[model samples]
Target: MAMSDVLDEGPFFHGTIADLRVGDFLAPGYRSNYRPEVVMNHIYFTALVDGAGLAAEIAAELAGGDAIPRVYAVEPTGPFENDPNVTDKKFPGNPTRSYRSSAPLKIVGEVKDWTRLTPEALEMWRERLATLQSDRRAEIIN
Candidate 1:
């Protein structure tokens, strides 16, 4: 795939209102862009392309009354790559680009902020991130 295709064929990241411990791999639900259930909860493994989108989702949930919306980094399993229904789009209420992976993704880790990354988690995230095509590496490096 071309660089743009990699950028677009994302196991794109998304932030949501859920409580999960680091290393937990539970399937989570996120809003979908499709019609009928315009604001439906889709249970799929997912992640943002970068940290900004995750932070934005946490902020929105906090503003909407969720006390502690934790951020988890999602890495898509290989099966999701070829799925035709997967999508990446900007949705209402969310502050950044959001995505929906129709297949289960692994929840590699969680963090209160980018600066709080544990060494182990950071290393693991580096591996997971290597699978994406984002231009936001500096966000995690700092």
Candidate 2:
């Protein structure tokens, strides 16, 4: 079967520290949330609300101080592909439901009801991200 056939449809979400309103466009060329040193070529998002929540929490933590984590319902304006960082390198498939698009993603609305990570869970994610940051071999597939 073709990989695209198995992908979920609709209800995409994006997580970030930036406060965005409906109709805002999220485009490429911004610094990556996972690796700030690299400017991203594509905007990343996921099909799962919880996945977006996790990303937002991490991004907020990284931004530090008074930054709010936010998840938004979004629509891609053009074609998107599976995020190779997870799909090709780690998961061997699009299990994360992560995707990237060179085109802009339009914010449809904010999602306020997604589950938030507990302090311990957040800390664990922090540690994991820290380890990845410290590892010279860990690279974001820009």
Candidate 2 local lDDT, 1-142, one digit each (tens): 2336448677899999889999999999999877889899999999999999999999999999998999999998988888888985898778899988899999999999999999999999999989987887988888
Q: What's the lDDT for residue 142 in model 2?
A: 82
Best candidate, TM-score-wise?
2
User: Once model 2 is optimally superposed onto the true structure by TM-score, how far is the C-alpha of residue 130 displaced, in angstroms?
Assistant: 1.1
Number of colliding residue pairs in each model: 7, 0
Q: Give the TM-score of candidate 1.
A: 0.41
Instruction: State model 2's lDDT.
Output: 0.90
Which pairs clash in the backbone of model 1?
Answer: 12-47, 13-47, 13-48, 13-49, 14-47, 14-48, 45-105
TM-score of each: 0.41, 0.94
Could you give candidate 1's per-residue lDDT for residues 14-127 as a string of tens digits? 454556655555343443312212333333323344453344343443345544445566665543331123322223333333333334656666644543345575466555
Give me the runs in candidate 2 sitting further than 4 Å from their true place: 1-6
**Candidate 2 displacement at residue 71 in angstroms:** 0.2
